[model samples]
Target: MSRDEHRHIPTLKRELAEGKITRRDFLRYSSLLGLSAAAAYKFAGDITGVKFIPTARADMPKGGTLRVSMRCPTIADPHIFQWVYDSNITRQVVEYLTLTGHDNVTRPGLLEGWEASDDLMTWTLRVRPELKWHSGRDFVAEDVAWNLNRVLDPNTGSSVLGLMKGYMMNDAGDGLWDANAIEVVDGKTVQLNIKVPQIAVPEHLFHYPLPMIDPDENGVFGVGSNGNGAFELVEYVQNGKATLVARDDYYGDGPYLDRIEFVDLGDDPSATLSALSSGQVQGSYEGTIAQIDIYRGMPGVSVHEATTAKTGVARGQVDQAPFDDPRVRRAMRVAIDPPRCLELAHANSGAPGEHHHVCPVHPDYAVLPAIQRDPEAAMALLAEAGHPDGIDVEIACKGDPPWELAAVQTMVEQWKEANIRVNINLLPSADFWDVWDKVPFGFTSWTHRPLGFMVLGLAYRSGVPWNESHYANPEFDAVLTQAEGTLDLEARRELIRQLEVIMQEDGPITQPLWRSVYSAWSDKVVNFAHHPTSYIFGNTLGLNA
Candidate 1:
């Protein structure tokens, strides 16, 4: 085995023994490190005393339509998708270069495998051979290169740019990515020379918004569904429905369902619940805690739940008045109790957050002292910030999702005691998206990401598009850069601790809890479960015979 391979084995084995990773995850990750699957399975079995067996294709009886109730999407450009709903529609037709499974282990998807340089600054990706696009053209190295450049282009307005800019772009300060950064080495090989050493390159490739698209499509998706995915889009209607049929010549394993349909039940959770209860659709995309309780007792329904880092943030744009003062930001953090918010909004189904973005699920997460709510201290801080008569502010959020609105309501009541008068501005789900990031004080729901750095880079980094709070701190950014490049777990954890401290002390957002997400399906559906990231993997689902 290679020196790097030897270094990884002990960590993988320790994680397996601690129940942090599954045997399948060990095997997949080991294989990427040049270990044979047989050897990896034996190594894992010896440690756990349990052999791992993969499910065979014959076990999945195929050929049925899976109709799921979800919000229909409007965005068709894969490079610039902003919402998970939009990705839900396009992911069926397009594929990603890597796939982060339910176990949070990233494995090759379109690529056969990848290798990183000793310093982790360069990555060499081996594209899988003979893969064909939905249009019957060959999938090649240039396709990958093209997609990367498209996302790196500032004019594209891709959400992925926020995540990749710091590591992959030029330091020329022109916001232009280095043209030579991504190179098509050969027909089946592509290489990336990044500006910084990033450890989460594989995971970032599977970010919901960064799906691999057909180079021939010219940056627009769903026009021809010209993808290399397991399914091809048959019909798509904005705010209505999208239908997809399986590709018989798909490169991957069973797309067990012959057809998959995503039906729009509107933004109301009640509408989706009604559709699910009445059998209008076989499954619902995601359920609120209240809806999950109802689905649990309903006959012929099966609920799948996963604890995730998914959570909502109540934030004030630091560039705006009142919020610009660190005193006011600190006051907001202590004004409300996270445990109480979790209880009122989620029925105490989730763990309280530590007022920072990092979650316990992340590998490099650093546990910090919990901040206690002190309304009196909050009032004092507000008074010190020149708000002696109390400050009146508005919190804006979408009416749908239910949880965001519920949490905001609880926060509003809590802030009342801190002499902070908060007005609730509940907009329709569609309209909320238009102004979600622009609202001075707003509540927004963030989906699950495998790495803490991924979300922090996208949402909190200075000058990025999704910096909801418009928060900028040179010290925090410097620490984050060191953490992102640190490969040693313990060393990374120390750097993460510093970042967490900075966030707790001066961050503009109050993250109350990490959620336990749920989804429900009828008994007729097979092999379908809730994904931690709330991704709909229609390709792996089937109908019971």
Candidate 2:
């Protein structure tokens, strides 16, 4: 193919993968460029595969309950929830400013489009006009501003706010909103003034934590009480179950199903799998990697599997003793072997690496030597750090899905080789969330973010509430800030490489494996696919006519 023929194809493929255009649009545009329909679709599939096809059924049946087995956390506040299950339930009722498709591309959601200044300091978002809240109130620019303000509010106690700490101006470290930080530029446009230049504004805006909320919305002691999303709140039983009815006058397209009921399975993956197998629930997004083979061959189930950057991390709080010494942290890193832990935990389903949620799928990915388990080296470092007698520490975890617990148990055995005594403190999944941050050592399950800098900003920034390790370095923070501000692809990758080196050398979190996640549904369900982050909602899901 000539340069002219291939140049536009690259841009068109990106548009299709990012969901800026549909597969039909890709086919139409590619055909104009002298390519067959099959060729055009093949190119598009190469970019994001078929997991994200816009499934619009013409003769779809209307009004039926879509039972889901997503286990929600104790806190259901859209912004405060730490796990995917909580976000899954809240996102059904509360829509985001930007929607991230299954292809990991972000498109307009509540906002029609957005523009940023050359300096990247000021951003202007054009809201979709005439949108309304589920309570029948007109949605305005103020609603958007209020939702963001809540995230910045310390009193709101939103865990995801850690991602926006430096991005948003909060000099007091308290979540108080700066009056000049946000401006309502007329009715349809909202302007945001950042403390520093940031090119990843859309990535943060695409977060599930930034869900639009009505000013009078009551998330506490209630569930799905108020939202501007495609579903209306009908009933809620906290930590148990909830039901949502589709809104007819929803601003956007279809939430084809009449209703969706979220059944709380807690941390029992077996119960969730059994429910899907028995025809009690039509679908579930919580299928585990260990059961992929079983679900794949099941009679009435269709399993959607994809390799994700999502990882199970063991956080060693640096502010606390033994871990306070950088040598001790390094010793911990070298003491445990990731591949062995992965095999023991996930049945060899995960790839062991130094990846902190940034997988090989990212465009900026660079191969770094995987950390090998060096028990002798770890012992020397432990002795050098003034712990010649070996250090005793507690590892807290919410044992679930079987693999994570197995991984943690294997880690304990590995640490013993380095003369490190580890006490396992296993808590229920719900109880784990309560002390996830406060605990000196714990396990956290992280999902895939759109960009590498996103996870870094959320989890590693100094003094941020979610900084699991409490590991602070001036140079690390500066590199992350610079990376997020730069729009150039190559420049950003260099900065990200610097970040990877920082984490590898002295960071306090141990990310062992990245696994393949599978979501399954009954054959009766239609128009559904698993997202890389498993972030899909019920808007386009339906049943056979």
Candidate 3:
């Protein structure tokens, strides 16, 4: 076995033993690592005492239009998409180099396979051969190299730049872009020489914000959808609808549906629910927790749920007054009870958070002791911060996504006991995004990321564009850097422990719970599963009718 295979098999086994992955996931991952089917089945049987059987697809008939209701997608640019709704639309055309599954396993997508150096500083990617774009152009190593460079370029304003540039770009020169970081070697192979040792390179490639686009096309995606994905864009109308048809020459598995139509139901969740109820749409992008009961009662509708690391965070700008005091921030953390918030706001459908950004789903998450909620302690901290009479604050957040509003309301009521007065400023979703990062105190919705370090780097790193709190701590930043480069899981988790404590004690954000997200689709839809990250994978979905 190769060194990479040896390293991965043990990790997979450990994950399986810990109940993080199932026996089926073990077989799938082991086969991907070059283990034969018989060997993989035997290996799994020895561990779980269960026989592995492959499902026959001969009886499954496909060829129908699947309609889904979602928010209007504005920007067609793959790299600059800010919302999950927009990516859901663009993903039909473009594809990613890697795919992180619902189980949080990172698998090769466009690339046939990849190998990492011992130090994890270099990754050699082998692109799949005989793949052609929807435009009939060959997919090659240069396309991958071009997309990496584009993501690294500061001028592109790619959201992924925050997550990738620091590790992938060389800081020796101007530090804006590094041509040597991504090297194209021949037609089907490419290499990445990163500045730091990152074990989650493959998972990072599957970050929703960074889709692999056709290198020859112009920067934007709306001009034309010439991609290598299983679906080809027939038409796309921003704020209205989009239509896609299956590509006969797709390199990957079944794009079973003959066609797909995505209709924008506006920002209201009710519209989507109505569409699903009346069969106007076969599927809905995401349904709020409050709507789960309604979905359960509806006939011919299947409500799917995925326990995710996704959550909403209430943040106070550290650079601003009141919250600038660590005492005040700590007071806020202790004043609100996570369990109470989860029960009241989320209908007790999710796991409570510990005020730290890391989730239990993350492999490197450190298990810390529980923090008790103390109203008296919060009052004392406020007094120590020179707010003996209590402090009045305004929290800004979007009115949509019902759970955010529900969470904020619950926290506001809980804070009253601590002598903290809060006024809610509910803005429209569009209006809120305009000032989401600039608000003094606000709520930001976060999606599930494969790694804890990825979200921390994007949102907590000192001066990054998305750093809403404007929190700058030398010790936190240094620990984060070390944690990012550490490849050993145990050692990295040790560092994560420190980071978690620091955040709970002094960070500007208070996260109450990790959400249990829901989606509803027609009963006729087969193989349509809800992803933990809320990603829509239409290619694998089929309509039984």
Candidate 4:
């Protein structure tokens, strides 16, 4: 019955009883803990076990530099920070907001808690009282309302505006969600009038592009401007290095480390990989399985892999020329063996991917079967599509001994057996997404996000900002919309399952492998991940040697 502050806050009275404190002291403790006298007695037992981590704890000694290595170059803007943190990692060091826990449940990080209307649209947010902003002003609901208003503002070019287009009192696209638009009744209570269920709201607070910019500073965004998180942005040298200092007044207790540094290596992934083994850098993110295995032998490094979402969207283009034909797409799907790809492609660094639009780790995901390799079926389809010998096409690939290249090589080797000619054009990734998202045919990397049905709406759904493949599925879109409105957990899962089936039936991007992503770091670094999208860097890593 260990108590988290989250539980203790709710059952203050019961916890007091368990602690054996006097009723008069219970009344006093109630006020000290910000609970009513009645609630203090009611939840006294729970309070007894509440773990209070005050910043001044003698055991919480903190002052050390954390070093982080990034696989990509420092970029200006990622545009789509809502689910995929498209912004530079240095910016992540400076921001804070409500977010999903590691287990993917709604968590109260920046905000104490929030409430949704019965309709699910239009939420009432309760900001954390007494929290301090980096600028030293007491944080209040105004920041939340202002940030949401910016996302709703059309001029901000916020990708969130598209996902939640209609829920705002004023349609942002047509210019209703404005800077001064949100109702800030006082300071602590702000009402967000969204037309959609407030599921993705937490995601909107993380990564780049979706940051909580200060309304006081116009065009004031990026690393230097934010300071509400556990870390503070200290330095950023584009495509080279970025650094951070701990935020003394962060809502989270502490970073445990004093500083975090990021080094960017563009076009030199091998050199970056070498640094981890040599101990020149504490950790390197988004390394291939081969490199990760190599680092495993190094004295003080740990490797972690996270399940990723593999959508046909933007990975490889399936809407043009040979790929445009659904039969061609089906043949491509049948051409490679998922088991072999999973085995050879990533070398068991990550989980064997299940068939779903999202990752298996995603909350409310449904279980499904993997597709078998049917080269005969693929050959038959290729012949039916006017080529007894397979059609020749080039693929663009990047990562893990170049898994994209390996998948292409496998497809080329397999398609040749079916009389198909395949050529893989290895594209150098100096920020691959910049060009990959626009490419007609290529395989790129991506991480799974927990926004549920929005996965389809963003990549597979029509008219999306990052729809790498031009796919049009009315039924899929309709089902996704239904899922968005369905609050029942299992019902949403079933809706997503239907959408997954739809993707399987109509894949615009041929999946050669469900990849296992890996990241390795020095023992000094803690709490880092190898994301599917390869975006964690700068602030997420805490230096604690």
Candidate 5:
């Protein structure tokens, strides 16, 4: 070995783990290689296995704070504490007791394992032994009980409650949509019972808004009162951002990174793209599919696109005079071109989804022929509906990105040839949802559900009562209900396929396009993935040098 900048011999010696390479041998070797005491110690440590470290010649460089950029400048307070989303970045900063695979399959997370009876009615949970909350409190079954009760409390007004209500045990279908009981036998064992046996119960436990909360009034975020995880929300600014530090005292696995910052970029995809390009943030969750090239083609970045895109669509009330007739809704549905939405409106990220709410990427999304744009058919329907001249209507939408404006503009232009005119009145985000309390004709992105069957709720069921477009039919709703518990995968899918056919023929919602997945990150991060809807591999991700 020559006394210079290289440690080729020691590197070889370390790799050999060969026979005795004493301190003198190491010292002599260091001297021959001109290694300083610090470098010598590093070499000796590597040789002795005292502080051995592996070479990282990959994207996964070690030990650095990852800068993240995302849309939704500020996620709601409750969402930050809970696993709900005002943003995708929320999952990276928080965790749930359970997680699902990309295929919407279920797996255990916080809880070690769970079991259910033959009928799948009663669920017994086994908590991991070393679980601890972010605040250093031992995570016990009490936290689980508290979390279940809190979400069910009408006052909390969690969106998940209504969604999870389908599992609670009920007599004669009475309490089917309410919490039956959650019994905590001890600090680690929990017995959860629903109204009846429902296979989906365990899967729904990790539903958004079910994040365990601290029961004490000491008012700590995810403290002893709640449960435990790797990253704890140490600080948060409403509509701004949040910062989380590693809980070195974490009970299970860990967040190898020292800290995580969720920098909110609001909902403007354009602004989000700017932040990613300008290096304001290393990665983001809020950017839309439109800006993929800007981030991926950059000097140091990699992009993994989702195979199936998420849907963004508009819906309307049918009980009213204008849309009461199926012909009226069909005319509007048949006239609009589906592909144009992704190009002109959504920035070409995703393809046009069928009239069905389920994405084509979804396992069970119906594969029936798409509804083609038929101006002739649209005109014929309008004439039958007593609107030979044309029908005019208004729509309500979040107006963020001015969705209503663009949607209405496009609809008006397209429908003009078919004798229908749409007046788009854009409303501010808050105002849009607020006005929905008094109005019903509007557009909305349906919630992502666990299965393709679940997506059926978007049009078949009243959806969320608050947003139902008065588009209900007893027959459609019954088929959806029957499909919910059939358990037979093939049967459920066939039923769903039939439902999509029925929707295209008579249902009121006009589902347009399924948007693609979009995210950006700096090379300083590793193990980043964009999820279908509920992102997994969140807390488990790490940062690199």
Candidate 6:
């Protein structure tokens, strides 16, 4: 190769490694410079490697009253509801276009199957013709299109809209609904014109935030239990309880339970755990590590653990003082002992937090070097950053879940070794989320997403609404965009590794642990499977009776 070409190769590799461009973009740009795809892919592979596989689960028996401690947080509105328990309730009444399993494989959920173009920009989904909604209306491609529009509706402010950006648009120039963004070619076929190339379209199709519902006569989505799920909403009492009855005409897989009841515990873990132990409820929708330990010793109760997207993250407002400097961020990361924090907080039930929030159980986990606790190094960095007398910062958090409070307490002690003094400010869960964006330093519990790209786009990528740290990096964004566009798994994995490294070095969030969320079930409850998504699969569960 010529000297000029050799010089450009490093830049191209860096772009691909950092996710500044997708494989397709790289190949297109490189061909002009006379580079081959084989050569380019080899260079990318040498940058990263795969080392983990997500554990998988199998089918369980179906039929029983699956009583859960958590209650319905919403009126089952797929677009507005944001909690896992809410999704667990809504999923039974409405099915997704795809089914993402514990293995992280996307299968046909509401749709028979789906296909995408080579560019990954266009997608075609085939709906099952024989399916019928709970309203006895035929399930069609338009229903799928309607739900996508619901999420894209700007006024509604759907949380998952970040994942569908570029692909979904208000093409009509009138309102949030757009016919062209999602086109119904026929009764059974729907085509999606994505804003950008997204190889994980099928996997994201099943995301709870993008719930597919049969539109009411007014064209509203998820208004009155109009879904094609295995179970039909029998009755819903907002914030109190929700009851669903199994549907005989259900088109998809098992909603094994005959009936499912969700009783709201009002964010009271004590009440929820008490109900589970006393047989008042068959299971608890969410169980912390402390709760699981208590249940493990209880007779006839089983604890199911799954690697979740749920993580305890320490976010710093990088736009503010101290954290505005990257050295301060790195200093805080190295000063805190993640392993000991995990031990103190969760009895080591979770893995130490890596540079990024992606869980170790994820298949796409790019094994970056572990961040070890180094007080001397941390102190040195702080000293160099002009904090010779050490630094004092106040952090906000909710004291529930027990572990979160314990984590903050332990972290304060660990950081003291580096002369960092932390002041703890505890708030209610509702209060914390309300003013989370305003807090300069705080601990917040983030729920799970099926893909690493999903969370990264929502919280880390610059300019996104949920980018808590307001972190912006052109190269990192480029890498993530390219990874989304490329179908090559290995290349995507390599891009994720680079993304993790970037976040590790300068990102504002100091993630200490990726906690394994659990569901505790009574012995009478049979075929209760654990899902990493943290949503309960009520349709597949069965009971001894």
The candidate scoring highest on lDDT is 1
Q: How would the candidate models be sorted by lDDT, starting from the highest? A: 1, 3, 2, 6, 5, 4
Lowest-lDDT window of 10 residues in candidate 1? 1-10
> Lowest-lDDT window of 10 residues in candidate 3?
169-178
**Which parts of model 3 have CA positions greater than 4 angstroms off?**
1-45, 50-56, 170-179
- Residue 237 displacement (Å), model 5: 2.2
lDDT of 1 at 260: 88
lDDT, candidate 2, equals 0.75
Give the per-residue lDDT digits (tens) of candidate 6, residues 1-545: 11134234566667778887655445433422323334544565565442233222244555678788875655435666555667887888777877766645455677766666556666788888798887788888888877777666666656556566534544332243344768889999998876677766776677677777667733343335577787877777776888888888776556567898989877668898788878889888778777677888888888888867678788898898888988999999999888888888988877888858877655466787788889999999999999988899999998767889898899889899999899999997767767776788988777876667778877776554466677877787778777767544467778888888888898888877878778888988866667877767776677776
Better model by TM-score: candidate 1 vs candidate 6: 1
Q: Per-residue lDDT tens digits of candidate 3, residues 1-545?
A: 12255356678777777877667657545544434455667777787888756544555568999999987657657787677888888787888988877756566788877877656677788888887788788889999988877766666766666676457754431244455778888899898888877666777788777888877675678735688887877787877888888878888778888988999877789999998999899998889888899999999999999988888899999989899999999999889999989998788987898988999877688999978999999999999999998899999988678889999999999999999999999998778878998899999999988677778877887666577899988788778877887755678889999999999999989898888898999999988789988899888888987
RMSD for each of the candidates: 2.6, 5.7, 3.1, 7.8, 14.4, 8.8
Give TM-scores for every candidate, taking all chains together and pairing residue i with residue i.
0.94, 0.88, 0.91, 0.78, 0.77, 0.81
- For residues 1-545, what per-residue lDDT tens digits would candidate 2 score against the true structure? 11134335567677778877666556543433334344665676776575334455676677789998877555446677677776777677778887656655555678776766656777787787887777777778888887788777777766556677776757556853467787888887799888887766765776766778667854442454777788876777766787888887877767788989988776778888888889888888668767878888989899987767778888888889978888888888898888887787777775885734466656555567788889999999999999988899999997776777887888889999999899999998768877888899987888887667778878888877678778798898888888877655567778888888888788887777777778889888877888888876788888763
- Give every collision pair in model 1: none
lDDT agreement with native, every candidate:
0.81, 0.75, 0.81, 0.58, 0.59, 0.73
In angstroms, the error of model 2 at 482 is 0.6
Give the poorly placed runs of model 4, Cα more than 4 Å off.
1-58, 78-88, 137-142, 152-158, 161-185, 196-200, 203-209, 216-223, 267-269, 305-319, 351-356, 383-389, 399-401, 526-545
lDDT of 5 by residue, 30-112 (tens): 33222344455566666676663432334443355655653333444342222224434444444566655453445566777
Candidate 5 TM-score over all chains jointly: 0.77
lDDT of 5: 0.59
Best by TM-score: 1
For model 6, state the Cα shift of residue 428 in Å: 1.9
Sort every candidate by TM-score, greatest first: 1, 3, 2, 6, 4, 5
